[model samples]
Target: MTAPRATKTRTPKIRENLPAPQTAEGLFFHYTPEEAAQWTPFSARTLRDRIAAREIEYVFNGRDNYLTGAQILSLNERYTVKPFSKTHTRVAA
Candidate 1:
């Protein structure tokens, strides 16, 4: 009689549907003073001063400061200059 052939057992594969990881562009609506300075025309020191003087809104997370998108929008509204009118010219009296 021939020896019985050994059978190999295979484990079933498991698949999971996990959420995609957040990227800097997607997750970072808030920014540090330094980061905000880099993204905008303001200097880091200027941002810090604004935070200190309460001219701008910020979040203090025990260790670091952060600025939100809404704050940035408000700042832009406050500081952004409108374009000069091309139709209106100064007439010498």
Candidate 2:
């Protein structure tokens, strides 16, 4: 008589509810407005304004818009710049 075969059970190791990065660059996640507000120094409204102004880059699916982590880095590059005041003006050579 042949021995009975054993059945195997598999279980997923990670939770499906956890957020995952969308891009291989690891710079983007799908975040709701509230989540973005807490993570970003800029308020949701201000972020929206910047988006409208094209000072920053973002992606929008039909339902929601998100700024990639790369976008955040880009913002840090240019957003902190202060305008040149008269006191700091350079004289023509």
Candidate 3:
């Protein structure tokens, strides 16, 4: 005799207004390609290149690239590592 067939449980997909865990709250909650562009003052292409180089950290799945609010702040702060002006340097003659 064949055993009884097990029934598969059906689950409904629920859509919420909540953001994903990887995303940051407040500003970077949810962002699209256009929104990502605004995160940085740089142009879109520049941002894409930076993302590819990993100079700025990002969460990427498939063709989607995501960044948190903290990440944006981090990128802004990265420019603080600039070198001093030549005049500020003491040259050894």
TM-score per candidate, chains pooled: 0.54, 0.47, 0.49
Q: Lowest summed-lDDT stretch of 10 residues in model 2? A: 11-20
lDDT per prediction? 0.64, 0.61, 0.61
Per-residue lDDT for 1-93 in model 1, tens only? 999887977543322332111343423366666656644458877998988898888878888677765566566677888999779779999
The predictions' CA RMSDs to the true structure, in order, are 17.9, 15.0, 12.9
Against the true structure, candidate 1 reaches a TM-score of: 0.54
User: What's the residue-level lDDT of 92 in candidate 1?
Assistant: 100
Where model 1 places Cα greater than 4 Å from the true spot, the runs are 1-28, 84-93
lDDT of 2 by residue, 18-75 (tens): 2433345537655543445544668877887876787777888876667766666566
lDDT of 3 by residue, 2-91 (tens): 999989975433334645434546345544434555556666567768888887787687887766666666666785577767657678
Q: Runs in model 3 with CA error above 4 Å?
A: 1-24, 27-30, 80-93
- lDDT of the structure predicted as candidate 2: 0.61
Best-fitting candidate, measured by lDDT? Answer: 1
